[model samples]
Target: MGKSDCSKLHIAMFPWAAYGHFIPFLHLSNKLAQKGHKISFLLPRGVQPKLENLNQFPSLIQFFPLLLPCVDGLPPGAETTSVVPLNQQKYLAFAVDQTRDQVESIFKVIKPDIVMYDFWFWIPDLARQLGIRPITYVVVSSMSAAYNTTMITKETTVEEAMELPPGYPSSTVRFKDEEAPIVLSMARDFGSGLTFYQRINTTFTQSDAIAFRTCREIEGPFLDFVAQGFRKPVLLSGPSFPETKTKQLDDKWVNWLSKFEPGSVVFCSFGSQSELQKDEFHFQELVLGFELCGLPFLVALKPPQGCSTVEEALPEGFEERVKGRGLVYGGWVPQELLLHHPNIGCFVNHCGYGTMWEFLLTDCQIVLIPEIGDQILNTRLMVNELKIGVEVERGKNRQVSKESLSEAIKFVMDKDNETANKLRANRAKLKQTLSNRDVQEKYINSFIQALQDLVKK
Candidate 1:
């Protein structure tokens, strides 16, 4: 009933149990740590060990592991989404949903000034019950939030789901006919008797304030649309990634990349979650596209489904043909560092939010082949709105053709291509703005002030 008083807020960070979600929350926590805020970074017990190496300010950002509740179909030790296949990820979601009790217990102990979370929609109610503010921090672009992300129920028609929300900012953000179903699919039953739509819609509507890892300069209209729709304070984190102060690319990567001439190597990485099925013709098309392009490439992706190893899945003589110039390995590679490598001329990717921003900051030319729903929207933003990249054309059934992939890469790589030249100029300007410290600090500062103001409200 009264204006709350606080200083140096102790915020609890509970992200979705996925590397993509966890890493961005940590990046924000790292930024907040610099401002002297204490963070209680909560995650599954098994995942803490993996994140320890990444915690830059372990002293200030403490890890408080939660005992992950097991689900019937989930694997014995599977704590994150990475261990689960795409079809079976609902089991992982069910497991995460069961953590509300555990989360509430910890919240009672910490009595954090705020609970910053994503995916766990129940957080708002729990935070309110404990008299702690809950902040729903979306790591994805606001454009996706405004255009593609909203309340689409199982009962919602395909046509309705395809239609943009009322007063949505951009007409340019249209989904393809084949891509329209993705919105409905995202909204379908994920787990815990809730669709992803209901989970996000509830959180967005109920959270004390909403935050995004975005800025007003580029995503201003979409951000405004979200604010208007939710009728809450929408704060921006401004793409504040953890500073890689002393980190360097591994020697093996450095040495291998050095062999290629500057601005010659094509780096292909489809995030941690992507795995083309061995049976799918596109998997072969993907590698063959690299061969067809005749460019030096390094692909970092999981081995396809039904295959135990990346080597086993390769087409006949495929490895031999591209042996010396190209490499396709499924292992942890430092993508952020590699993006800045001298030889990385072009980056072919799936356009995950974190990856998109990371690649945008680099001099590497972008060639997008987005697979998932959000990735498709991100690709549209890059190719259609920002004009920063070219997307590989997909067939009616969303199948990737080797010719299309090769053509997209070649188009961007062409020295004298007009469209490529335009993309380069636009991207250069954007790179300057995005990488500017002052612009970024202004957004983060505003976000902090908004949080403090919310306490007063």
Candidate 2:
């Protein structure tokens, strides 16, 4: 491969069934296509309709949609993880595995230069068998990835199993023995005979190269940890800032947000994948946290199972009393636009990677109330590592109290305390760097250069 070879690289994008995983791959594909490379984005037929940015890229980017195979437990036409309930995600994985023959056939026809995939860790084996290079596109933070790899890649003795990993931040944060259940559950619900952690190890070992949605400026040490641990070419895919070119906002939401003063409203959301119904008391505390702060708020509420309406989901008279100050909508809202709005002063979030990047794009302060998966790790990065946000203290049962939530909100929103002022200033600096178009482009270009270099070997 020579310098001129960069122009003709045919890349195949096969992301996991979840929207969080799919969106980053889409962004990367668009970037690759812009550089005169051909991109074949493979996804299920049902997912194709949900991609609003499909037409934004050049014609070089082609969508190769496949009909999803039905599994016994999975609902009909439920191709993406977003449509499937949280508990039933494993069925989607089973369905995706069933498409092995179909995907292999597409590979034979298109004969892509490289196949870039997410979470479907078995793809590297298939790509090798087909004589095409394989790339693993990791969507989580480097710290989360490193921690997970350290925990799962080797057999652990009884003592090591109960303790946090050697290099983990023990003083700042530690995983309790009880928390083992949470980590273990991610491995349990996968469709493959191998656990999800095992798949991650396999993917790292099998792929030609690995790419992450991060840059060295923010996560240098953790990225180095992964590179050294895996002993492979770990590429930085930038934050893959989502293209906001197609800004679609509903008139109802726009009109509603207009009433509040600039940087005064709190936007609350916990992304699509989280099962937010821990307990009724927990839900009440979350509502009261906003009211106690006396801030105008907008909540994109996804009610727990069996609760159809927000009124039924929340406490009685809760909506009626907060009618003027808060609005609770039960469906989709343009989150990108809402977060960018002038009135949104704080984002009370579940600390998902996708949502974290969205908050970093704005000057809004983050109020981390992490629930599951890598969210706790992400929250620690924001709160302890970066000093950009405040974390609300959860009680013995990992439930947030209203008082603690209010305190965390004020710590970010008020800016009266020196600590709060420093956090805001630091966040402003990060916002400048993370939101820079040129910086993100540089990372993307470097990744392509690395990929081009890999082909030569």
> Who wins the TM-score comparison?
1
Evaluate model 2: give its lDDT.
0.79
Badly placed stretches (over 4 Å) of model 2 are 1-5, 151-162, 168-178, 246-249, 278-281
lDDT of 2 by residue, 1-457 (tens): 3447555788999988888887888887877777778888889987787784554575888888888887889999898877887667778888898888889999999999899987777788899888789998889887777776654523444345445556653345445454565665655646766566776777777888878988887778788877777888899989987566666677887788888899989998877765456254366668877778778999776776567766677767878888889987778777878888888898988889888888888889889987776887788888888899998887776768888888888888885789888888889999899888999889988888888787667
**Model 2 pairs whose backbones collide:** none
Query: In order, what lDDT does every prediction score?
Result: 0.85, 0.79
Task: Report the lDDT of model 1 for residue 189.
Answer: 77
The alpha-carbon lDDT assigned to residue 45 of candidate 1 equals 95
- RMSD list, candidates in order: 2.7, 2.6
**Worst 10-residue lDDT window, candidate 1:** 1-10
Query: Which residue pairs collide in model 1, if any?
Result: none
Please report how far candidate 2 places residue 110 from its true position, in Å.
0.6
TM-score of each: 0.96, 0.93
